[model samples]
Target: MDPARASIDLATKIANAVSTVSAQPWEILTERNPDGGRTFEAADIARLQQIRSEYATLSMRGNVFCFREAFDYPGFSINEYCRDLHPNPVGESINLKIQAWSESHGIWIPGISEHCHDIAAFLHPEAGEDRFIAVAKCLSVDWYLNDSIGREWAPTMSPAGQANAMALREHIVEISRAMKVAPDAPLIDKACVEMLLEMQALSGHPTWFSRFLEMWIGHVQRSCGNINAENLGQVPDVFTYLQNSPHQSGLYYTLAHFEFSRDEYLDWSTLTEYCLASDVRNLCWLCALIGGLSNDLISFEKEFVTHQSQSNFVVVLMLNYPALTLGEVVEAIMMILRDLMEHFVTLSGALKNRCAGRHGTPAFRATGIFVQAVEWGIMTTWVWQTRSQRYQHARSIFRETQQG
Candidate 1:
């Protein structure tokens, strides 16, 4: 009757339930084409390289503008943010992986290197240059802080590193509050602070920006805790794992970024009620689960081999269903993903029907746009996962780590 034992029992029950369901091969449910169904054309190779170069330039600018003096680690350089922080035995940079994935998926835009711009332009072609640049910077800093810095340093963080992270958390809260009041205020020395100000200035609704900041804060906090749990070798039960996976998956920020990108269509004052409504929350949560679970499914082998499975759903399932093979657990996850997608489609239709009479209103239009963005995100993520070298090289990296 101890707490850990109870969790294990609950997880076993859940895993048994999952094993009862038959899973089909994963297929795309949304009709929307990823990158407009464009494959990498031979003639486009040069242009794609040029686009990657531009993003590298932007990344360098981000490192200098945002991270230069942000963390107090000895010998810390902002240049580190510009490099691939993820373990890569192939020596390919993160930017290179992004470029390759984007190009092959045909998501590559000639002038727009950032995915935010692609979503924004898809929703509103009239979205201007300044807004594009601002969103790009927002994404850059978000990646630098969470993916690059947090992933690289959190696991083995010394007392000094923990202090640095805590300081950043405090600074982010202060700046988020300050930006809500004076969005155009002078830039703070911190990269995240400046990006928030830009996003707030361009955001369609005050509440949306506030919600976005809140989600980001939660993500940072949850990521730290999850990493600590992993360090301690504590495997959470299925329910607890589900509760935390979505936040750590970074899908909350993805949803927020989608909203931020289509700011011109949103009228937060009119949409505020809907934003708080359960239907809308359900839509967002479903999107996050789909994304988070798909990531866990694809990265399962990597994490399992690396012994970093403490935070992975697949790992939790394996622990509960000790007799189940990895292949069986994967199929179970796929089944769960398919069910979530079906639910999303049904709920999205209902939500759209609820707004049928107000088609011309900002709220109605925004709802439609938001639903489309969610569909796009889901399809794009699945397609990218299938083709991305980022997830494909995990075994090679693990082997190299062992050899070293």
Candidate 2:
């Protein structure tokens, strides 16, 4: 809570109040005003609601895009979401009015349908077609949607959020019990809830919902010039063995690196399913394949040992149950990487079994260590790049720990 954030929070109520609601609301804006007043433009509202489906709308591409990826598409339109809520299949005069209103309000005015101009004059009276679109695009719909999703505001309030919220209330109750009083605030403030309810129509409320779009776009361009390697912190207390035994620390760290990378692969697959490849072909392709080379691995031969080479598909899945939670890609690659590591570990044990010159494959293990450190270095970069909004301090700490 720095001065800037403090100041923003202090006057947030006024700032929030100034934001305008959509021009698209027919019954609400036309039939009824923002205040509790009423409007009876039932005919007009019905028409707009009908065509709402066909109009271009704003929405996140998918849930995957929610936490990762950046949205670069510029124009803002509600065509997508409207249809979901209300499909305006017929083109009527009021349909045209919807278009005119969109144009006047800088909304990406949809093409006029047969339903045009019943309620010719509008209340807000948009400036013109282009300006209306500009205004609509300029709306902070992205921020609003993202904030709602992240806060788990509406969705959370329903069941999941409420469950956690109840626990939270219990804590509050404890504090209250200490003082003795119960809260009287409405379950959720109406004004706050309105933002989410407003977005209920979209395919994904924050469609093309790249919350980290700005930072990721910048990172991909290398505008920030890749700072991953320069950010590996010393092995933390949790990995004390790695810190004390730099060599061993490196090995386990390497294993962890492979694990994390495989996990991201799973996340990426889940994302593809949620947004990009929602078709049959993509699903099949996703389901098929060697699962591809894991982004992180110590060695092929070492990993092969742990992997049951002859296991059938079903057994493989069962053995890899914990790994699957990593999502998809990571799971597949990890199986491979595990097999390779096990093989190497076995080879080393065999030498010790025969009372050979060396009891351990120090060099093989050593290489694994280096790989982990490097992988960790890359992860440090990825987190800062992909999750910068949520993890602001990651980059700085990474730099401090890993910088040459």
Candidate 3:
């Protein structure tokens, strides 16, 4: 669901919860708590809600990062995202704010009492579909991540809940695979297409599956998504799904985790999350290779993730500076080609060993997400680099090029 509708629904749900309990006069507990300086005036709430709305509409950083992370898809980095989102001055720090927010609201969560709070706690009872979709969107997004603020969020689940979770996971996988096999649109009646073949089985009412499927596929094709490369059918609706897809893939986490702690590589053991993402990065590259697309960016990014480059990066200058002598191109080309070949070998081994067996096609299917995130980063750097040799000049040239 979009953000404004989602927020409205969330507000309603919280309000409803309050109203419901207040029917018997639910008490608003007045504990001796310190006031948080981050005041939420009516204006603040309006701005915040609008911010949420824009996130939904634009499929901004949160939507991209969260969604990509959820399905083991390759993802975008929030550090880089912060620089792009432009939501706050000085590129706001999410973890810092989360830490502050957590400290202030930690007590509000039910732990000692055994009844942890949910969004519904503060929501109105009469939540609308859109608002619930918004709140549920966050929950669903967060549900994919095992923790938020480094605290576990696996709310106590009854046997049924566990079953449902497993079932939904399987359902999504199956549906995604079926969609993969679907022929190019216009081959059959467009109305027969199901956005999610698995979920379609459950849409009992007059199904919107056809519309969803048609739009989603069209969206991917138009967006140059590597996921549907085999089909390349046009559908405009799929863009909607990008809003809630996981955001960070291995690159994002690697960069962000490193940002939060420079010793991320040394502490790689602690990087338990985004394991699938690490695998997905390689998988995405594999998909592009599988399709035999000779795009330099994908080929290079896959290589970077596989092995460290040993060659000097000045080779980039040779390619663009055509006025340079052949000696320069040859010398640099020799170095660049060697690195490329080595990277390719490393990539093949990485994917085949680290992912080819356990991760295979499903990971490949999620490549669209991986490509999307990388494209965003790539396009950003691409535009910036053309403007000036700002951040990536002295860097391996491949550092930004590798992921972009």
Candidate 4:
């Protein structure tokens, strides 16, 4: 056989083998549901159903700082970090506004805007009322976008599937021209295009806008690839998994949102250099790694319960380290997270000191904000993953296992 054909043959075999093995568990965990139904303990059903209400309460607890105490920067108050930002009456009004906007656009998400109050508040409390509205809109829109993209275009081995995938990819490319071309496409694509266009409008330079657009494009492709791989039951090795970390964790899009916090344009070279700096780059990688790993650990049981061959990092780790028990794999991931959190604090202070020295320079200010945003992303993600009803099954089933 030709080498290319031979390689393809091997890949297919590996995927088939993985799919077969994934269906049969070497170790038992959660109780599987019959008739291909969702695997839920009776109690878990109430938890999942009440997720929307549960989240509303959690949202009211407001934003809490995780690692802000380790560093201080001027113009950015330490007290600001310590202070709890309780949303005012305007927050409800903003939610209603966004909800109505989404409904008008044919993308209303029931309970999503209400539940994400804390998410928007946690991520961008620094924003003024109007900016917070924008952030809220983006978050609401994101829920719809993820559903449409993932549910509609997740890879399948069919002619129609290939066509849908290509169309979704092209939609991203043509999103900027969506208004001019097709005003009545799915609300998700239109909303996504509007959000990106708003970001581009706020970003004076095309370079940053272009960079963000590319990031979104890459995110869709990488995420869809993982979904496709999961469909095929192909598990990636650690390195390949880690390489997908940034995209999977949404680090780039998180940074793009942070960019809006800076009004001044950072030239390509300056931003690149700061991004490439030892502490900055390493801290980012660590954040992405921690986020990805933590998500896998949290969501593992959900996959098991659903009988979905999710390409979770813990499963990938198990594949590589065959002797490790499920408990051991959980522990290893937790240890890695603890270590990364420590490293994040240490690097945050070091980077803050360096930025303090160059405080007068634009680069330093930009770098400081970038680091702060990254810290927020990591810590906030932990809170969301742990508390969100989205992972109710994971928490109910695996929480004790993780603790042990």
Candidate 5:
């Protein structure tokens, strides 16, 4: 076989295995996994570990692919998981709060209130119940307020709306300043304000949570620019979109929150090593690239229907590569996702190894946790978008094909 063909073949296999393995929780297979305290069947654990080890090897060789044409949209069922592992009252309360908050704010987020438990389980399976519930609530509030309300409620077409949005950005700046002295400081929505306060209370470093708010504000400001472009009937070019992608995807806040939310409080040095390290920053960018592309590919149909595909990568590809049909553009994007995934996996492994070597050091452990959290973020975001009804509303050829 030709070497290039050989790589493609190996890449194809790896991609297929990843889709299958990732949809199922690895926590079921191992009690020792980083995911919060969820139980998995012993048999499944053995198989998943084998696949994970294989993926690590193939990824190192640069022969692994992340997704392919034969992909199935495997949506996770909140009801099923809840049935499997009954959540306590706190988990139940948070779920209700998420839904109520979303509904009151004119946002539509399917399964989030119910899915919060599963998300908490999937992301922090080894965590205690209290820790898991707090994390779940934080994630729910973040997604609801940041993605849903921020996108839906903002005025995208008028000067006044834009001005109003800017005013909100100023409030975020104030909120960040207040978190150090008064985490419960006043804000626009009491629920969101309370949610941030709760997250701050739970976090090892409340300052990190404040920083997350600042990053979120930055993303909101940049998003206003994108919406303004759309209002002017201008689509951002591929280069411009890439430049704005990290903030647009809310990567900074998510990464910052993960750094602070750990059960173990990281010291200043470890926090610096994880947050400011060049390699770690690069890894985050790569993860954002994967996440942005995956989101574009998954949500392309809805976005296109809503006339929001102007900034979408798939649309960008179609515009750039006119000879390619939409189907071809989708496939090309998948290949790009795979290529990026390979890079992400390789970098993550390198970071893990570097940290692992410093066994007894706090900075080393913090670095290790950061890499693991990034991996989880990349994979979980993929899985969530795949299953999310929020992005599944628009009917398109791509949606039909995925279903078929």
Candidate 6:
């Protein structure tokens, strides 16, 4: 009857359920891209070297964590579909700026700079030169603003911080209006404003643009609300914690980024209707849940060591179930992740079957691409977390427990 034993028992049940599901979806989803080949120009390689040099210099100046050599998570490995999608010179340069800005603003996480390049390049691999550059800029700005400012700052904002946050929110609203009304309008020299301008020029659908803005605004509002919720001091249960975790994970923004790819292939109405479909919506949420939970698992040690354990999923579980040891909780989380992955695989197949009738239609194509995007999101997140220096210290515990 002990809580820890009960959790282990539940995890056993989930694992048994997982054993019956076909893992073909996992194989299909994680398969490498057939066109993953690339031939970078000499200039591209040189630019990458320069970015590496800059990162090395930055690393030297601080006590940065070293990247982990490996993480042992069974059945979850790096998704190589975007392995060749390294950032171009423009993206690399903007990522440097993003790192500098975050450090200046006191929001820099040691390895976050690495994300700017990989995520942007992965999400926009097929984009043309201009659109890819625009996407890189927007993604860089969004990363810092949403993760650094919205997540890190808003939760603990003092009155002055709140004032500054308010100013930033208003500025975003102003830029959104400008983007809508005068797509060619000139903005200030700020990176954030320039990103808005770039998005305005490239946004394939007005609905996508509006929805992205709405999500951004909602992030700000929800984050600000946390400041009054005593910085998420305690939650009644995992369900309550999960309600907010997905948003904070920034997975929705990633979904919006995926929409950029759909712009070229699907009409606005089709895209809109597809996004509204129950299966599509469920897939998106599952992506969020998987990504967020995996993040909490990987980052638990770092957060705990840094005293930022208040809002983490592991911390929430620890608070609720005092009888559970850290290892037990981690094991339970792994089991839950497996269950979620099985469910995603099942739903993915069902959705594909539904689209089978319209094989060559835009809806069908969109469905294929969307499912692939979700798979990429989940796997890429795991890959990044395991390889990133941000969570390097957790690797020791992960290996000791052997439950990652």
lDDT of each residue in 1-404, candidate 6, tens digit only: 67467667756753553333212242222221112212323443343334334434533443222212122235533344335434344555555665665455444555665644556544544545666666666655555565544544454556677677667666665665555434544232255556666776688775777666655554444442233223433243455555555556666656776767546333435645755355666677677777777777766555443333345666556555555554456667776776676677678777777667676897677667777666666656655565555566422455322223
| Model 5, span 9-59: residue lDDT tens | 434643553344334332321111111111223433343334334434543
State the displacement of the C-alpha of residue 56, model 3, in Å, after optimal TM-score superposition.
Answer: 49
Can you give the lDDT of residue 252 in candidate 5? Answer: 62
Off by over 4 Å in 2: 1-192, 201-404
Model 1: which residue pairs collide? Answer: none
C-alpha root-mean-square deviation, each candidate: 17.7, 29.3, 26.8, 13.2, 14.5, 13.6
Q: What is the total number of backbone clashes in candidate 1?
A: 0
Sorting all predicted structures by TM-score, with the top scorer first, yields 4, 6, 5, 1, 3, 2
lDDT winner, 4 or 6: 6
Query: Against the unseen true structure, what C-alpha lDDT does each candidate score?
Result: 0.51, 0.24, 0.27, 0.53, 0.52, 0.54
Report clashes for each candidate as comma-separated counts.
0, 60, 37, 0, 11, 0
lDDT of 1 at 363: 73
Cα error of candidate 2 at position 271, Å: 20
Runs with alpha carbons beyond 4 Å of true place in candidate 1: 1-128, 151-153, 156-189, 224-233, 264-276, 302-309, 353-357, 394-404
Q: Compared with the true structure, what per-residue lDDT tens digits does model 4 show for residues 1-404? A: 45344434433433443334234331210112112112223443343334334323433442211222222333443344435533334565676788787787766656543454456655664556755666666666655544444422343336566567557756765664443336667766777767766666666556876666666665655554225333444445554555565665456565666656444333446646766354565665666666666666665555433433345665555554444444444445554555556666678878877778786887787777777666676656655555565555412434322221
Residue by residue across 278-317, what tens digits does model 3's lDDT show? 4433332322221111122222222211221101112122
TM-score of each: 0.59, 0.17, 0.19, 0.67, 0.62, 0.66
Which candidate wins on TM-score?
Answer: 4
lDDT score of model 4? 0.53
Which ranges in model 3 have alpha carbons more than 4 Å from their true place? 1-276, 286-341, 347-404
Stretch of 10 with least lDDT, candidate 2? 223-232
Q: List clashing residue pairs in candidate 4.
A: none
Candidate 4 lowest-lDDT run of ten: 28-37
Superposed model 4: Cα runs more than 4 Å off: 1-92, 111-117, 148-170, 173-180, 225-230, 262-276, 307-309, 398-404
Candidate 6, superposed: residue stretches over 4 Å from native:
1-4, 9-116, 146-189, 223-236, 262-276, 353-357, 400-404
**Judged by lDDT, which candidate is best?**
6
